[model samples]
Target: MGVLDQLRKEADQKKLSEQETVDQQALRAKLYKTQVLPKMQQIFKYLQELAEHLNYLEVPVQVENYSDRFPRLGTLMQKDYKINTDGYGGFSDFNKLVQINLTFYCIGKGELEYNVQTKSAIEQENAFLHAKRVASKMYRLGGAGREESAKFVVTKKIPVRVRFEVDYEQSQIKVMVNNHTDFSTYTEVWQPADIDDAFLDTLARYLLRKDSEFVSLDITDEDRNELRKKLQSIKHKEEQERLRGVTEQKNSGLEKKEKLGDKMKSFITGKINR
Candidate 1:
């Protein structure tokens, strides 16, 4: 091939690569706007509702939204609860911490990801442990220990980190909780329509139970069932109100048509009389 022809070929390939990058970014941005943003908002609402539902349980919950930070990414963070047990073993007190972060990103094929990190530590009266425990016992049971049961310890006060990734294009959800001690992963493939408020609420419950080892958040199963019923009732009421508003609009339109007809009839009568 001639030098000029080679140069031309290289330029064309470079242009094509740049265009591909632009196309990928544009597609990701569109997915972020339509799918990711709505899901993130729904997740925030779910967490807020869950927090309110668990209020009677006196669970210390904090939910925050960072949706305005687009281009960079948006996040909904929930710090579920914190508790420290009475001092034991001379000077060490067991502690539990649960934090779940749902973050949105417009990247690659487009995705929404959530990372949940739990820190269960043994704090000496006035100091933190140097080698903080990576609470792996949460997943040690339920056949998860087949990975490394020896390395996974079950006592309270150890820290753990688990990540959940949602792939919008693939319609899949993946979970992984790995540390220096143990490594475990789970995948749940779902229909596109299944990713909604109800599903997210269920996920919230699952993550909390998994990380906290179902520690009584001072809430019983009955209490959780009641919360579900309350949420359903609120949704039904909202649907009723929406239908009522639509009916009112239809009635208003009918009234306007009647008034216009009456005006026309009066004009015709006057014209015929004249």
Candidate 2:
């Protein structure tokens, strides 16, 4: 090939590559502006409303915007926010508070990743132990040997996790419980536009309910039986106390009546003597 023809071809290729890069940049900017930013704002607003509901229920909750974590690109870096139940002032009844992390990958095709976490290592360990116990029980009931059960069924860690992904393509929220590979899965989808205050309130309550279940995973069958016995004992004591109170009232009333009769009799005797 001629030198001039080769030089021309190289120049054309360079120009085409630069144009493609520019086009890709423009597409990303448009996606962020139109879809990503709007969706992020909507979710933030929803979470803020949810926090209000939680506060009304006297649950310590805080919603934080974490833009400083990823600082770059136009108006916002990434839609990274966290809603955490603060365990302070002895307010949290549960041993562990739920921490929800919602992050939107805006640089890509706006996918929202939802993760639930807790800081209580003890609770996690207890849950793992309880899982093993339950697994062993099930294996025994199924006529499987204890050694086989221990080897096959018992996992090292029972990390209590609930994950959901906002699928924009299908307009559905794919929810995975405990582990992704588990058959226990469901979809909880809400249109971005349709998410209102009522929805947020329900979502907050649902999250709380799930969190409580996760925390209570440590309670085994033995613990439940013990609790049942204690409750029965308490009821029996209460019944005894009620009966005692009634007896005391009746005895006091009879004593007062007898004293009144004695006074009347003494007055009558004194009058007759006079």
* Predicted candidate 2 versus true structure: per-residue lDDT over 144-211, tens digit per residue: 33221111233222122333334533333333343211212323333344445654555445454433
RMSD of each: 23.2, 33.2
For candidate 1, write residues 146-190 as lDDT tens digits: 432212222222233343344644433333332211212233333
lDDT of 2 at 90: 26
lDDT of each candidate versus the true structure: 0.40, 0.40
Residue pairs with colliding backbones in model 1 are 120-157, 120-158, 120-159, 121-157, 135-159
TM-score of each: 0.36, 0.32
Query: Candidate 1, overall lDDT?
Result: 0.40
**CA shift of 207, model 1, Å:** 5.1
Clashing pairs in 2: none
